[model samples]
Target: MTQQHGETAEVRRDDGELIGMLRQVTDGGWVPCAVFGLPLATPRSAEAARGFLLDHGLGYLADRWEAREGGEWVTVQIVEARPGEVTVSYADYGHPKLFNERRTLQEPSPDDLRRA
Candidate 1:
């Protein structure tokens, strides 16, 4: 994982090495926020930054996925994550066909879909 912001140097590491680095970040830097009904990270933590890489699957924060039905790139924010299911919301806010659901958007993980 690597993060680049405003002239700051790049810090890159593999996932296996990520956990130890997360521990090095100071407590003061960790900002509390919501994630799938849990509080696990903050902006200051790189592991928190990669929190988008769901244990159950792949992708990054606010990852964009191409809709199978309409071919639109819908941005998604993971609201819930499980083995075969992932609940998400419109990271892009809304779209006519996608937002048709009245409740939280519950969908299957990309792995569950067959190759096109």
Candidate 2:
């Protein structure tokens, strides 16, 4: 996201959907592509950037997700998944009904892993 300066690499999902492009900045740091509203990590090497994306890529959208609402963690449904912007709705373990909320994808709440 930083001004797009440096070498670039294309990262894709298993299904060949573009996750995002890694941008190497002037500081010799590699920035991984963003997915599902997740934060962009600036890694020191392109290898690290690619590894991070391959491990936690767009596939995350298919997994169950939870969100904090009013200080309580509740299961939510991902209504939409896109780079930098994601929409979620409060789920009742059935169909999601309620306000569609736009979240920064800044928080990840999985069973054993936490991501930013």
Clashes of each: 0, 0
Summarize candidate 2's per-residue lDDT along 1-113 as a digit string, tens digits: 21233366667766777665576778887777555434356565877887777777666556666676555566666667664456666654432443354454533423312
Shift in Å, residue 99, candidate 2 = 9.8
Give model 2's TM-score versus the native structure. 0.49
Q: Which regions of candidate 2 deviate over 4 angstroms? A: 1-10, 13-16, 20-34, 39-44, 55-57, 92-116
Q: How displaced is residue 11 in candidate 2, in Å?
A: 2.9
Candidate 1 lDDT tens digits, 48-108: 4344323412323244433333454555555544422445554445675565332243334
TM-scores for candidates 1 onward, in order? 0.30, 0.49
C-alpha lDDT score of every prediction, in listed order: 0.36, 0.57
User: Against the correct fold, how does model 1 do in TM-score?
Assistant: 0.30
